[model samples]
Target chain A: MKPILECKGLGKSFGQKKAINNINLELERGKIIGLLGPNGSGKTTLLKLANNLLTPTAGEIRIAGFNPGPDTKQIVSYLPEKTYLNEWMRVKEIVEFFADFYRDFDPDKALTMLSQLGVDAKDRLKTLSKGTKEKVQLCLVMTREAKLYLLDEPIGGVDPAARDYILETIISNYHEDATVVISTHLIADIEQVLDYVIFLKDGQIALTSAVDKIREQEGKSVDSLFREVFKC
Target chain B: MGWDFETDRPIYIQIMEKIQLLILAGVYPVGAKLPSVRDLAQQAAVNPNTMQRALAQLEEEGLVITQRTSGRFVTENEEKIIQARRRLARDQVTQLLVKMRELGLGKEQILEIINEIAEEMKI
Candidate 1:
């Protein structure tokens, strides 16, 4: 089967700044992949390129065989770095909005997850804590049975306990044929769930390898390796 | 409960060791059905794919057997379990010997220390 997400000579620029440059990657199905980098390393830029939020300056990116467009959006579930929900909207209202917007969105699953996370369906987004808001957003994004999940810093800003819950949610909710790409600087917390990792350095592909291969070959965790590679 | 993993080794190997220990400790009794891969992965907070890989390795080692229609189960053969237990004990001994040798201890010294510990523990 073809890769769920593929990029060939993919480049993106914001005027004089080259946020992403010449990235080539292919992610397979049924795997959780980590897209890792430091701040300004183009992790978000690459995700935006794939999500169709920003058009690449050069090259191309494909999600499930189609370019980033309406067709690909149908199969791609994205969780942006910041919460984008309306502050006045209740948790359930956001779920309803997502259900109406995305054909694949499962409202039942979203409501169940919201309750599990202790975010009441009737609570307004403004009333929820930062971490709870993130959980609610994650619940909405994950309920979609999309082919590819682009989670940008999904665990960031959450407490340790909530982080574990989020990770467990990601693991248990994974579809055998779907692929998840989680971009974050918190490698140690997420590495165990990741099958592969792609390291981006200054918008360039520094390295990409199986997480186990790194441990077996280098006798070190991906977190340590990242520290060494991106040491200030 | 979340599974602990050492940083210097492959996670699947650690997961395999964990399951093997569970089997030997009778936590997962002989011939008992194992949890589904997704459930196991969620319990361990690891990826299902990684959990699947570990289970597959266990199956290859004869510690776990998979049925066509049913899910995975611990081996029913007591002999196989015995061999696995012995293998694990041997590995522990080999590691201890290596560490002792690195500390400039001779084989006799290591054996003497083991005897002292065994007597102290009344074993």
Candidate 2:
């Protein structure tokens, strides 16, 4: 299958400091990719490059054979690490806003997800707990029919139970033929669904391969390898 | 269904697989009781959620049977254990054979070594 996202010598810098350096990646369709890295290792920056949130300092990145821009954003559904939703918007209104902006957004899917989480659309976003808000954000992202989904820290916070739900929701809802790049530190949790992994360290690609092949060959889980290589 | 953390595999899978292995080994015995998920999870130092995933998977695969509130018990059908073992062994041998061929060991040489090793088997 053709790569859904391609990066060749991709480098990003902020001022004099490097964010991501000389990275090459090929994201295949219908694959769940885990982006593993220590804090400040540039996993988020690389995702941003794909989303066109930040322009690369050098080299190239292509999503679905197109450079990242408004056209690419249409195909890339992003869930930022921080809350991207406005606090004052009612749950129902926010869904409409997303539906209006993104042609691929499915209002019915969004409603189904919210219903599964027991979130009432009439409630204001500010009244919901932080965890609930996160789920709401997840519901929105999962509602899209994009060709690529860039999720940053989808399970960074919240309790362990919620983590399972978050992971399951992503897994069950994501459309096939689309690439899902989940940048997270929770390796053991999401590694089961991961077709590939990109381990970043000090702004560089440390390791990248099929998660199953690594497990089959090295007899090591992705988490253990992460601990050994990127251990503090 | 306790997990071994040392292996690269996830703890939840370890628990599921170990229980499956015990069933295959006849250690649990057919139709006998299995450890509670809570106890097994505690022994394995894993979260109950993880344990739940393992149990759910086992149940889905028909390797285990659960009763509501009465706790999970081993299934009477012993063929599942044998089937699991056969599948696992088949995979291992296929992998080993492929690797041996890559190392220039022909089938006869590999079988001779296997026979030699089998001669010293405790069983």
Which residue pairs show backbone clashes in model 1?
Answer: none
Q: For candidate 1, lDDT tens digit of each residue in A50-82? A: 989999898889887888988888889999998
DockQ of 1: 0.85
- The number of the candidate with the highest DockQ is 1
Model 1, position A105, has a per-residue lDDT of 91
lDDT score, candidate 1, position B18: 98
lDDT: which candidate is best?
Answer: 1
TM-score of each: 0.95, 0.69
Q: Worst ten-residue run, lDDT, model 2 chain A?
A: A167-176
Candidate 2 has an interface RMSD (Å) of: 8.2
CAPRI verdict (incorrect, acceptable, medium, high) for model 1: high
List model 1 lDDT by residue over B1-123, tens digit each: 389999999999999999999999999999999999998998888989889999999999999999979999999999999999999999999998889999999988888999999999999
